[model samples]
Structures are given as structure tokens and as C-alpha cells.
Target: MKTQNLTVKAVSRGLTLALSTMCIAITSACANFSGIHDDRQMSTPEHYTSSQSLPAERGHWPSADWADQFGDSQLSALIAEALGGSPTLEQARARVAAAEAFSETATAKTLPHIDADNALTRTQYSANALVPPPYAGSWQTENRGLLSASFDLDLWGKNREALKASVSQTEAARADAEMVRLTLTEAIARTYNRLALQFVLHDMAEREVRNREAINAIESRRVASGLDTEVQHKLAQTRLSASKSKLVGLDGSIRATRYQLASLMGEGPDRGLSIARPALGMGNDIRLPDNLPADLVSRRPDIVAARWRVVSLAHEVKVAKAEFYPDINLSAAVGLDVLGLGRLLTAASRTASMGAAIHLPIFDAGALRAQLKGRYAEYDGAVARYNQTLLTALGQVATQIAELRTTDVQLNDARDAQNATRQANHLASLQFQTGIANQLTVLDADLNTLAAEASVADLEMRRRDRQIQLAAALGGGFVDASVAHPRNTPAAVAAR
Candidate 1:
């Protein structure tokens, strides 16, 4: 009786120790909870400044829808269709779903596992004189059932850290999806702009061809009347033919650009959608913001993804560290067994069992240490990658700003040159009509005018290209509250 009492006391002491350990662990974990960083605190920029002399204030890119800025309803419709139908976007969304599933699995590891099982068997025993009386039964039936549960205690926060890592990865996947969306938007916008430019160049080429034909006719009449040499007539013919060839090349370019735009819009190469010429009067009116906030880093989807990846790697390092600590698990089972099916549910035939297990890594040839080392290295790599991505994003913004400014100056100069050449061509043509100037002088003025016109057209296209670059650099549109938390929100920014 004393031995049994001592055993009881020992069991009570063990239970008390386990409870105390659990309470201490719980309190420690709760205390650490306050250390979790508030993402909102990181949303605002530490500094804001405007660097350029532009009239617009340094701010987030304009929120105006890029397609609407072009004032083309058809372009807007095409962009909408592309966003809805693109296969790439669909694939990105699927990746997000897969990451979410992985997160769910990780979270499940932190919870208890339960299972139910049952079995039945029949046995025959021979009636032998040497056998005991209880074994003399001819036939016997047995039944068994069990309901079991098991759970691992997060003593070292291993499960919690793994779960947190998974959640961070899921957020990164979401940011990747947003990146795909932004890329698709930029592609469609740039393609549409290219198509517009192609049309403008094609029109200019046709105008040049017509002008060359008219000049060739005048030279041919002069040669027939002995007023000009055959060599001069031949030169005029050659110029007309060259202009015709250029017009053909421009036509091919326009067709190719149209096909490309169709493909970007998720249409077949041979799709018959026609793009009309853009109304040409709006030149260089788009204003870019000069001063941007430092928090602009968070606005870019790729940057947000990189940052989340770093967070995930940080959690991974924690999980790796947890491997150096002991792991604990608890398991229990309650069931019944009986010869008769009716007795299976009775307490008299029931059995109950429970167990606790602890595992410590004493030695594994330094494998755990190696794993921890690798994870730390990965964490360092992630931090470096995140910093590099931030710098690259800032560089892109700065480059676009400089390009926009330079393109504005070039466009202004091209317009001035075009105006001057047009006036000179008009005067030269009048002089040729009055026989006060030679045909060669008229041809030179006409060539200069054509070159200036083409330059202006080219500059206009460059300006549009610069606008697209600026839009991409500024994270595709105006910043919203959600832009400050790209990992949590899937907001679309219009490129304008």
C-alpha cells in the first residue's frame, strides 16, 4: 500500500511539472507577440522631395486611366479584353491558389490530428483435453474499435514559424499575380501606342510618295521641252521610285504592328480588328510628377514581392533554429473490445490509453547545424536581393524622369524645325512656278521639308514611348491606400 501511494504521488508530481512547463511556454509566446512588426507603421515614406524644375509637384503617378488619357474608346475596350482573356494572368492566379493551399497545409500542422478505426474477426478453437477449459470453445467472435488523437506541442515554435513562413509565401504569390497584371497592362498600352505611331508614319510616307510623283511629272515636262537635262529627269524619277519603295516598307511595318497589337489583345494574328488613326493635336501635354515619396518602393508589385520573400526567408531561419530544440507530442486513444457485438459499446468492455513523447536531437553528424547554416545563408541572400530590387526600382524611376524631360525638349525642337522647313518649301515652290529658281533648289527644299516632317513624327512617337516608360516606372498609376500594402490588397492602377 505504501508503494502504490508513492507511485500516485510521483504521477501527480509529473503532471504538475508538465502543466507548469506549458504555462511558462504559453506566457513566453504571448510576450513575444508584441514584437511582431505593425505593417502599417512601415507604409509611410521617411522622406518626400521634388527634384526637378517641372511645374507638377513631386507625388505619386497620376491615377488617370491610361487608355482614357489617350481619349480612344476602342483602345480602352481592347485593354479590358486583354486583361480578361490573357492566359498568363490566369496562370498567375492559379499559382496564388496553390500557394494558399500550401499555407493551409502548414497551418494544419499546428493543430491536433484525429482518426477513427474499427475491425472485426472470427476465430475457431479445437476442443482438446490438454487445453484449458476456457480454450475449449468451438468458435469465438471478436470486435474492436478505436478513436485516437495526437498533437505536437509547439515548444520551440517550430510549427508556428513554418506556418508564418507559408503565410508570407502566399502573400508573395499574390504580389506576383499583381505584377503579372501590371505587366500585361503596360504591354497592351505600349502596343497600342506603337500601332498609332505606325499609322502616322504610314500616312507621312504616302504623302511623301504623292509629292515625289508630282515633282517627277514637272521634271519630265522640263526634260521634254529641253529646259532640263536627261540626267536631272532621271534623278527625279529615281527619287519618286525611292519614295514609292519607302511607302511600301511603311505599309509593311504598319501591318506587322497591327498584327502584334492583335496578338497582345489575345486575338489571332490574322484578326481583322482595325485601329483608326489617333487624333494628332495633343502633343507633350502629359505632366509627370517630379517629387516622389520613398514609400514608392512598396507601390511596385515586384518590390513588394521581393520584400515578402525576405520575410518568408526570415521565418524559415526561425524554423531552422527550432530544429535544435526538443520536440513534444501527446497522443491518446479510447476504444472497446468484446466477443459479443452488443457489449462493444458498454463501459465494462471499454479500454483507454494515453501517452506523451519527447524527442531531442543529440547528434546527427551536424546535419541540423548544416541546415541551420544554409537557412541563414538563404536569409542573407534574400536580404541582398530585396535591397538590389529596391535600388533597381529607384533607378528605373530616375531614368524615366530624365528621358521624359529630354524627349520634351527634342519634341519642341522637331516642331520648330518642321515649321521652318514647311515655310521654306512653300517659298521655294512659288519661286519655281515663276521660273525664278531652278528645279534642283525646289527639290532640295522639298527634301528638307519631308525630312523635317518625318523627324517631327518620329519625335512624337518617342514622346509617347517615354510616357509609357514613365507610367511603368511609377508603378502604373496613382498610389492608393492599398498600394501602401501591396501584399494584402490587389488593387489595379490605371497607367495614365
Candidate 2:
């Protein structure tokens, strides 16, 4: 009895020591968890500098109705249709919704989970000679029902970090959707501009063909009257044939452009959609800003997406570091054990128990540390990628600005050349009518004038295309000061 008593005392002492060690371990883990930095302060970059100035408020492009800056209602309608019906945009929006769902799932982890369970059992027992029994034979029934609830305390901030990561990813997805919308808008504008240019060229080709035909008729009349040689008539016929061939080619180009625009608008390739020719009016009244502001980069969706990705990676780093600490879990359940179903819920038959669980990593052959190192590398890669994105954005803005300036000058020169050619052609035509100039001189002057006019048209179209590009580089439209976060209108959200 003395030995047994001593053994009992030893057992109690061992248990106390075990409990003390466990408490120490829990205390150490809690301490490690405390020093973790809040994500808001850590995830934001230490310095975010815009490489270039923001686009000025008084830019040539107006903030409202960027599409209407071209003064073409048809073009604006096409842009709207593409934005509304684009499959790519829809896919982007779906990704945003999916990310949002994932974020919600992460958030749900912080709440307690409740569950219900029920069980029924039946058993038969037989009496044995060596055992005393109350009855000769007995049948027993047992029933149990339980409502269990459990929660993790998140002492390590693992769940919070995961939630933040998911939220950042959702923001990135939203920015991606906006990027897609902007790209689609730019594509539609470019296609529309090309279509307009092609139509103008087609008209010019047809006019040239008509002029050639008239010259051919004149040459034939002159030859019949013995005033022109066969060589001149043959030359005029050759010019007429070339003009007809060019006209055919232009028509084919026009058809091809229309088909391409149709496809962009989510229609079948052969769908009949005719684009009207843009009105020809020359005006240089548009005023471009001399200096851009610095905050324009942040307004760009792609740049915003890059920034979000950096934040997401930062959260990922936190999540990875969390693996170094122990995870704490708590569980509890209350139920009953009974010989009959009717007594299952009675006080005499009821039972309850609770437990706390902890999992700590003492040794893993360096695997956990290796995984942490890999995540750190990933974070570094993300940082580099984010910086690269900023540089590329700056490069794009600079290129657009330089091209816009150079094109402005080229457009001015082209207009002057067209005017000079027009005046020269007029003088040559008058001289020919009065027999002061040969048909060859008039033909040369007319050809020069036609060439100059075509150059002017082409330059004008290029200038407009550049303007659209600049608008796109300037963040599609203007950034609304009121829109601090990503926003979807009621209609937009409903459509999704």
C-alpha cells in the first residue's frame, strides 16, 4: 500500500510537469504570434513614385465621352456595342466573381462551425455461468443525438492573413477586368479608324479610275482627229487599267476591314455591317496639354493590378512565415449514452467532454524551412515584376507623348503639301485648257495633287489613331475622384 501510494504521487507529479511544459510551449507560441506586423502597414510599399507626370486636365481629349472626341456617332456606337457584348470582358468579370467567392470562404473560417449528428443502435445479450445477470436474456436499444460546435482561436493570425490575401486577389481580378475593358475599347476604336481610312482610300481609288477613263476618252478623240500619237493613247489606256486594278484592290481591303470589325463586335464573319465614311473636315483646334501630372500611373488599371499583386505576395509571405508557429485548435461535444432510446436525453444518461489540440513542428528534415525560402523567393520575384510593370507603363506613356508631338508636326506639313499641290494642279489645268501646257504636264500635276491628297488623308487618320492611343494610355477615360475603390454600378452588378 505504501508503494502504491508512492507510485500514485509520482504519476501526479509527472502529469503536473507535462502540463507545465505544455503551458510553456503555448506561451512561447503566443509570444511569437504577437510580434507579427499588421498586414496594412507591411503590405503597402515603402515608397511609390510615379516615373512621369499625370495627364493634364486641360488635355486635347475631353474627360467626358472619350469616344465622341472623334465626332463620329457610329464609331461611338460600335465601341459601346463591343464593350457590352465582348466575351473576353465577360470572362474577366466571371473571374472577379470567383475571387470574391473565395474571399468569402476565407472569411467564413473565422466563425464557429456547428454540426448535428444522431445515432441509433440495437444489441442482444446472453447470460454466462461465470457472470451474474439481472435477466436471462435481454435486448437493448441505444440512441444518441448531439449538437457540436468548434472554433479555432486564430492566435497565429493565419486565417486573417489568408483572408487578406484573398481580398487582395479579388481586387487584382477587378483591375484585370477593367484592363480588359480598356483594351477592348482601344481595339474597337483602332478598327473603326482603319475602316474609315480604308473607305476614304476606296473613294480616292474610284475617283482616280474615273479620271483615268475620262483621259482615255480624250486621248482616243485626239488620236481619231490625228492630233495624238498611238503611244499617247496606249499610255492613257495603261493608266486607266492600273487605276481600275487599284480600285479593285481597295474594294477588297474595305471588305476585309468591315469583316474584321464585325468579328470584333461579336458577330459572324460574313455579317453585313456597313461602316459609313467619316466626314472629311480639317481642323487643328484641339489643344494638347504641355505638361502632364504625376499621379496618372496609379489610375491605370494594369498598374493598379500590379500593385495589388505585390500586396497579395506580401500576404503570402506572412502566411508562409506562419508555418513556423504551432497551430491551435479547440473542439467540444455533448451527448448521451443509454440502454433505451427514451432515456437518451435525461440528466442521468447525459455526458459531455471538451478538448484542445496543438500541432507543433519540431523536425521536418528542413522541408518547412525550404518551403519558406521558396515563398520568400516568390515574394522577391513579385516585387521585381511589380517594378517592371511600372517601368513599362512609364515607357508607354513617354512613347505616346513623343509620337503625338511628332505626328502633330507631320500633319501640319502634310496639309501644307496638299494645299500647294492643289494650287499647282489648278494652274496646270488652266494652262492645258488654253494650249499653254501639254497633256503630259496636266497629267503629272493631277497625279501629284492626287498623291498629296492621299498623303493628307492618311496623315489625318494616323493623327486620330494616335489621339485614341494617347487616350487609352491615359487610363481609358479619366479617373473619377469619388471612386476610391473599384465600383460596379447597380446595372453592371445586376448584369453580372
Candidate 3:
């Protein structure tokens, strides 16, 4: 009777110790809960700091068909193709999948784990063994099967905190994938614009060569008639040669840009040679809405991804802090056991057992606290990066807006020069036909007009490039899908 009382008292003491450890862990976790930094307290600006007004938008923040605004069907198609084929996007997708799988694993840790086993054995009993006399010196056969299950009590919410961290990481990964897709589309558009500019420049160089050749023919005829000096004829030949050299240089540039575009599309370099020239004209037809939302920066994928990372790290800190408590688990098993296979399934031959376990980190040497501090440091870093991305996005949009305005002024000047040169060339042509002006004057006028037109073409390309940059800065009209997790969706400042 005294032994039985002692056993009961020992069990009661164990249960009390476990409960006390659990209470301490809970208190520690709660004390650390408010340690996570909340960025939402920071004041969000109504408009870009660099600009008072943002560019006009039509339907959405950045229209879904922003590429189509360039009016180049080929460019639009190429962007679509690059998005579908680019390895960069595929890598992002794989990362997202991996993060999601990790989240599922963390969630599973919060639930019970179950397993089953079966075994058969034959053994000979020794005569001096602690067994019945009939079985002491004889061989025996036994059959057994068992099912067991175990679950962590999660008394300090450690498992739940771990699950939350994993979910945030998964969302961050998805946002990273969106960022990759945005970058790929922007690259394809920019490359296409560059390729088109090269084609246009090449055509301009060829036309200049032909015009110079025509002038050389005229100068030669004048020299043969003794009306022009040998020095003058030599000058004409030099000009023609220079024009041919320019055409050759432009051919090299065109080929190189094509190769770059091919690599971006995930195709062989030679594939770029088969691409047709794209027709792109510059104009500012797209406009931003007069009212820009305060959450515009939230649409940026980098910002969103960084925000999610901070959230994940915050939860990780909580998980680390939770480790200050004890870990408790319960397990049980029930199975049939018999000396003979025939009686293995009988109720009388059954065997069963159950157990509970508890482990408190008595001597970890400050490892858990160090890990929690590291998590806090990581959270702080993510917040800083998120702020930086926001600033960068704002600067890009403002710079692009200023550039577009400046380029518009430059375009106007170019148009005026082109018009003046066109008229001069027409007048020179009339004078040459009537023998009032030399053929040399007409050729000079032709060259000047071509130069003016090339300048206009180059400026127009810059305008198109600025438009693409602005659209990319504005997040390219991407919308985040709601995640099916604890938080449902990330906060707005870190997302859209």
C-alpha cells in the first residue's frame, strides 16, 4: 500500500512540473509577441516625393495591355513569347512550389502522426530462463501487429507560430515569381524597341550611301567636263566612302542587338536573324488617371515580396522564443501478440501500451535566444529593403515623367528642323534642274534632311523607351491573388 501511494505521488509531481513549465513557456512567448516591428505605423505619402502629379492612367494603375500602347503587334507577340519561354520565370515558379511544400510540412507538424508495424519471430527458450517449464526448452513462434500515434501538445503555440512563418514565406515566394514575370516582359519590350531602332538606323545609313553615290556621279561628270577641280572630286569620293562605312557599322550593331533579343527569348542566337523588322511610332496616347491611389507602391512586386519576408521573419522570431518552453508529446500502441500464429488475433492474446514525454531545454547555452535575436535582425533588414524598393519605384516613375516631358520638347525641335531641311532640299532640287545651283548643293540639302529625320527617329525611340520604363515602374498592372492561409492575404503596405 505504501509503494502504491509513492508511485501516485511521483506521477502527480511530474504532471505539476510539466504544467508549470508550460505556463512559463506561454508567458515568455506572450512577452516576446510585441517585439516584431510593425511597418504599418509609418505614414504613406499621397504622391511621389519627386513629383506633384503622376502620369495619367486610363482603366487601371498600369493598363494590362501596356505593351500594346506602342502599337507594335510584333513587339507584343514577342513579349508574350518570352514570358512563356523564359527560364527565369520557370525558376521563380519552382521556388514558389518549394515554399508551398515547406508550408504544408510545417502545418503537418501541428497535427498527430500515426504509424503501423507488423512482425513475426521464432525463438528457443533456455531452460534457466524466466518462462513456464513446458516452454523453457522448446522453440516458440509469435505473430504481432501494432498501430501507434503521437502528437506534440503545442502548449506554447510553437507549432502554430512555425506554421505562420512558413505561410508567409510561401506568399513571399509567389510575389517573387510575379516580380520575375514583370521583369521578363519589360526586358522583351525594351529589346524589341532597340532592335527596331537598329533596323531604322540601318535603313537610314543605306539611303545616305545611295545619295552620296549619286553626288559622286555628278562630281565625276563635272570633273570630266573640266568644270570641277580634282580636289572637289576627291572630296565627293571621300564622302561616299564614309557613308558606306557607316552602313557597315550599322549592320554590325543590328546583328548584335538581334542576338541579345534571341537570348532573352530563350532561343538560339541565329533565330534572331529571322525576326522581321517591327513598326513602332512614338506618341503619348496613354495617360494616367488624375487620381493616383495611396497604395500604388504596394503593387510593386519587390515591395510586396519584401513585406512578406518581414512578416515571415516576425513569426520566426516568435517560433524561436517559443522554444524557451518544454516540448510535450503523447503516444500509444495496441497490438495482438501470441506464442502461436493461430491465436494472434484472439482478445486474450492482446497487448497494449501508452506513454507521454516531456523535454525542457535545461542547458542549451543561450542558443534559442541567439536564434530569436537573429530572426529579429532579419526582420529589420527586410523592412529596410522594402522601404528602399518603394523609394526606387517612386524615383523611377518621377524620372520617367520628367524625361517624357523633356523628350516632347526635343521632339518638337527635331520636327521643326526636319521640316526646314525638307523645304531646303526641294528648293535645291528645282535650282539644279534649271541649272541655277550645282548638283553638290542639292546633295548637301539631301544629307541635311536625312540627318534631321534620323534625329527625330532617335528621339521618338527614347520616348517609347521612357513609356515602357514608366509602366514597369508602376508594377505592370499585376494583381496579387489571395492566398489560402492563416492571414488570407498580406497587409496592404507590403502588397496590393
- Tens-digit lDDT string for candidate 3 (405-492): 8998998999999999999999999999999998789989999999999999899888888888878887888765442133532353
lDDT of 2 by residue, 148-217 (tens): 8787767667788788778888988998898888888888778778777888888788878877887898
lDDT of 2: 0.70
* Model 2: lDDT of residue 467: 71
Q: Against the true structure, candidate 3 has what lDDT?
A: 0.77
Q: What TM-score does each of the candidates earn?
A: 0.82, 0.80, 0.86
Name the 10 consecutive residues with the lowest summed lDDT in model 1: 487-496
Instruction: Go through the candidates in order and give the C-alpha RMSD of each one to the true structure.
Output: 7.2, 8.2, 5.1
Error of 1 at 178 (Å): 1.1
- As a whole number from 0 to 100, the lDDT of residue 481 in candidate 1 is 48
Off by over 4 Å in 1: 1-56, 121-141, 278-293, 432-447, 478-496
Q: Rank the candidates by lDDT, best first.
A: 3, 1, 2
Q: For candidate 2, which ten residues in a row score worst on lDDT?
A: 487-496
Question: Over all chains combined, what TM-score does candidate 2 have?
Answer: 0.80
lDDT, residue 355, model 2: 57
The candidate with the higher lDDT, 1 or 3, is: 3
Checking candidate 1 for backbone clashes, the offending pairs are 58-291, 66-496
Task: Give the distance in Å from residue 341's predicted Cα in candidate 2 to where it truly belongs.
Answer: 3.2
Return the TM-score for candidate 1, rounded to 2 decimals.
Answer: 0.82
